[model samples]
Target: MRCQPRYKGLVYIWLKNKQSCLLCNEPADGTAPICMACETELPWLGDHCETCALPLPAAGLTCGQCLKQPPRFETVIAPWTYGFPVDSLITRFKHSAKWPFGRLLAELLAQFLQHRFDEALERPDALVPVPLALKRLRQRGFNQAAMLARWLGASLDIPCEEQLLKRIHDTSAQQDLKAEARRKNLRNAFALAPDAPIKGRHLALVDDVLTTGATAQALARLLMEAGAARVDVYCLARTPKPGDAT
Candidate 1:
């Protein structure tokens, strides 16, 4: 987690001035291909729950659900709430193979995480992407979480362990399920790779979004049971409670 900043700093400096904004085609103003105006207009997450990163009115407060039944992961870190152009961008990136949009989001997420690392948030020893099932992977051609993880790992200099987890079976798509059904859908859905070096090592799960967190919880619990010291989630965005508009 403790990295020499000069190398990444230089890389970002090069990234900042190299290309036009992907969103507006204007000059990029920061560390990614996004203009200053468009960047500000993105749905940046405000203060939220300490555990799940759920959007909330106040800071330093855990949401009620986490209080009642604690999650296996230590925390969730997401830069934006799922809405607006963020949602549209992720949709296109995931479904339409718009790699640039995904790359742009991943770069910005790396910047957001770098600030957190500077502020002394403990960095994970490795990034473990949430794996897609074989059927879905065959159809999609690529795993969005794996792509995000690789980009983040390259930018942040963290090791990406793409094979640490595997989806054991395919299930109904989570987006179509309610919170309770989401949990049920993920039951027995994942497994740790044999001989994975998880013991006592902090690991972060990388994904595109944190919805009900059912997927994260199942995977994190598996890792923790496998002797992982801690687990955290890193994602592009977090959705508000179901049926709530942000």
Candidate 2:
């Protein structure tokens, strides 16, 4: 049997029940939590490195760093450069337990991923969020990356595996460390679950932000050692190289 179309009035009422813009408090145009205007004003990563998604002077090219030594992950997909309101939103979401901001960011990232999937990007078999050390998880009461991953997984109908990667060390935070130090700190930091069957699987590592990328690299390396065929990094924002402005 063919289903009848909803009345125009009913559609409008349903739309009204959706969320409004968290930044400007304007009614969102569609499923997004932010209005179109605010979305346009976001620090969109226009031109970036094809491999790392680092902001570049031009698009469709690899950055020198990637050419010198490629990262473990194949490609990075981030919609925004870590700047302005994006950084502020992430800080609040991660530090202050502001779940609404996190949800808004995750919704936007999911939309971007959907577009990529539509445009011939290969979908991953599962999403594994970069795990937090037990100490940090207890301190924060939640893992921000896990929350974002679960939200995106539900939106995109992909499996979210929180226990696929385990953090075995309580390393110092990466924020204040130099790039080399960050890499060193994350070395041997992540371990794959012994019983997880990941052979030949294409996996996407979900995280809130990509800074120096040390965490993602560590996790990706672990997945590769476990016989995973490919690893892709997915995050909301990517920060410019250390000491470089966005």
Candidate 3:
């Protein structure tokens, strides 16, 4: 006797797609160019420090660095760890101008943030992408943070202000610097726009990645000084502390 094939229904048919995963070239499960298995293996952040979002041994606890000297921002919210394909994706998006990667990252971040907002997280009144120095902007022809902020704001229905903050100093890159030097380098790097109406507003500062968070601290302090009620940091990924493995 021949057995009949089981009918899985229309939902399965609707989800079937011919798209391939961008990372592994496997059949993608959804609109994203990544498959479910690959997505599960991505560097998702877990058990992080509440104050700085640094990878911690457990959740809801502050890191020692944050406890000793708290950053200007109220909290850091990043969805991924800066590892594996996440770092590669960000580098390609930011430095190599791979916009599709950026779009995908932004979409994922937005989805994560939306869920957070639904689950008792307070939404910010506005988003401010960390500004690029004029010289650097001219050289790069675009700001990766701004691009992410625009996509997030559109998705989340928050106002995104690109001109609210200005990068006054074209300082050297922060990638190679120690924590102390990074803070010192960004001391006066950011300034608020003269006419930005940020007073009493809960603002979120958006960026592609949060490493040492020197840049976020500098910008948050500037925004607070300009009368913002609260400042939050939102980034795609957070790097682990130096000498610590993720």
Output the number of the TM-score-best candidate. 1
lDDT by residue (83-149, candidate 2, tens digit) is: 9899999999999987878988998899899999999999999999989999999999999999999
Model 2, runs deviating above 4 Å: 1-16
TM values, all candidates = 0.93, 0.92, 0.91
lDDT of 3 at 124: 98
Evaluated against the true structure, the overall lDDT of model 3 is: 0.89
Put down candidate 1 lDDT per residue, 7-120, tens digits, no spaces. Answer: 431122334447677777887866577888999999999989999999988989999999999999999999999999999999999999878889989989999999999999
lDDT of 3 by residue, 219-238 (tens): 88888988999999999999
After superposition, the stretches of candidate 1 with alpha carbons farther than 4 Å from their true spots are 1-16
- Against the true structure, candidate 2 reaches a TM-score of 0.92
Model 2 / residue 161 / CA error / Å: 0.7
Clashes, model 2: 0
Give the range where candidate 1 is weakest over 10 consecutive residues by summed lDDT. Answer: 5-14
Order candidates by lDDT, high to low.
1, 2, 3
Q: After TM-score superposition, what is the CA distance of residue 164 in candidate 2 from its true location, in Å?
A: 0.7
Model-by-model lDDT, in order?
Answer: 0.93, 0.89, 0.89
Which candidate's lDDT is highest?
A: 1
Q: Is 1 or 2 the stronger prediction by TM-score?
A: 1
